[model samples]
Each structure stands twice: as structure tokens, then as C-alpha cells.
Target: MPTPSEFFDPSFIAILKLFLAMLLGGIIGTERAVFARQAAGTRTFGLVAMGACLFIVTGNYVDVAYLGVLSFDPLRVAAAIIMGIGFLGGGLIIFRGDSLHGVTTAAGLWIVAGIGMAVGFGLYLIAIFATFLTLLMFTGMWFVEDRFKHWFEEVKGDSR
Candidate 1:
């Protein structure tokens, strides 16, 4: 059977990828906002993901279109993106007296950026799976950490 016309159109595929990246980022960001109460929320994350997707998709297009005029390395852009996100994440983190805050939020931003790149590179399944894993870590691990802390306190009390 012949494939649908939309499947062959690069524009359509790019739009779809951008949309999916935004959706995935929004999901992760919502969890962070509502549960973790992080500063970066749904709209911020959605914009980040879509921005990464656009960068990668545009880089790929340029590389393909100008195959001989100049050399274009998509990895270069990806690396820059990682570095840029690191700066943004660093800004989100704050060190106070004997405590640090926004570390998880910073890390989540970095990972969500990677997820956006994956969507841009046509790895939909991997991106989706990673999104779910991120949510599981953010939500499920909180409960686990609390229980472990409680158990440790109980054991310490008994020993004393």
C-alpha cells in the first residue's frame, strides 16, 4: 500500500515533531509544578522543548539543503543546547545555609531538553518512555524517599 501524502511531506512531519515535543514537556513540567512546586512550570517547559526541537530540525534541514556549500554539524547545536540549559539550570539552583534547593528542577530541565531533542530526531517511542520515567521518578521517588527517611529515624531511635 502507498503511504499517505502527509507522511512524505517534511513540513508536516516537522510540525508533528514540534507538537509532540511540546506536549511531552508540558506533561513533565505539570508534574514538577503541581507536585514539586518548582519555579519552572508547564509553559516554560513547553517553550524549552519546542525551542530545542526547532533548533535540531532547522539544523538538520540546513545540513541536508546545503550539503556542499558549508559543513553543518547538528551535534554542535545539540552541544550548545546542553550547555545553554546547564546555565539556565544553574540559575534555578540556590545554595543556602546547609541546604540546596532546585537541584531536581534543574536536572529535570536538562533531561526534558534531551527528550525534546529525541523527538526532533524522530525517536518518538524513546521520548515518550523517558517522559513517563521522569514522572515516575518525580512522583514515586518522593514517597520512597520519605519512607526511607522515616525508617532510618526509627532505627536510629531504637539504637539509642
Candidate 2:
């Protein structure tokens, strides 16, 4: 049997962080899938979050292990992750004349990456709160946006 301390080991904590990241990402992705009908849903968001968390955790481990031997900036890994996510987000966006699609989905992916990084850094409360806020934005803001659109259309029609 493993000792209680073993459960609190760094490796175990890292795994926990990854799991939390995935769970949070999946929650956002589920909202997108069910409501937004986006193609990149739970699996995509979960993988993005998990991959980001893995990069951060591994970077931290490398930094600590090479403390005196080599100079390593873990923040560089985070910057790289953000840049990569930006590239991915760009791919999600499509512009056609007067309309743009997938902007919100791209933004969601970006925020999801940040959430993963926060979880990797053990900012559990912040990550959870961010996830909640994200859900609110996705669902609540959608309703507000739709209402505004309808109201604007009605006013426009009356003016015409």
C-alpha cells in the first residue's frame, strides 16, 4: 500500500492539474457543441487544454531540474502555447464579404488555453471561476446578443 504522502507527490499533483484542465475545457466545449453547434467540441477543447497543461507542467519540471545547470524560462513555453493557440484560432475564423464566422469559437479556444495554463500553475480557483465566466459569456451573452439583434432589426425596419 502507498503511503498518504505518495498521493501528494508532485507527479500526482501534475496529473490532477491535467485532469482539471481537461474537465474545464470539456465543459466549455460541451456548451459550444450543444448550443453553438460548433464542429470543434468537447474533444478538441479537452485536448487543447490538456496539451497546454502538459507543456506547462513539463516546462516547470525542466526548470526545476536544471535550476543551476541551465537557464530556462518556463514563461517562454506559455508564450509559445499562446502563439500556437492564436494560430489555431486563426484557422477557425472565416470571413465572407460582410460577415465573419467562428470568431467567438476562436476566442473560446484562446480562453480555454489560458484556463489550462492557470490550472497547470495550480491556480485552481481562478481556473474554475474563469470556466464559469466563460460559460456565462457563451450562454448568457448569446441571449443578450440575439435580443439586441432583433431589437435593432425592428427599429431599422420602422425607419425604412
Off by over 4 Å in 1: 1-6
True-vs-predicted CA distance for residue 158, candidate 1, Å: 2.3
Tens-digit lDDT track for model 2 on 42-118?
99898899889999999999999999999998889999999999999999999899999999999999999999999
Q: Which ranges in model 2 have alpha carbons more than 4 Å from their true place?
A: 1-7
Q: Write one digit per residue (lDDT tens) for candidate 1, span 29-95.
A: 9998998888898987888888888899999999989999998899999999999999998999999
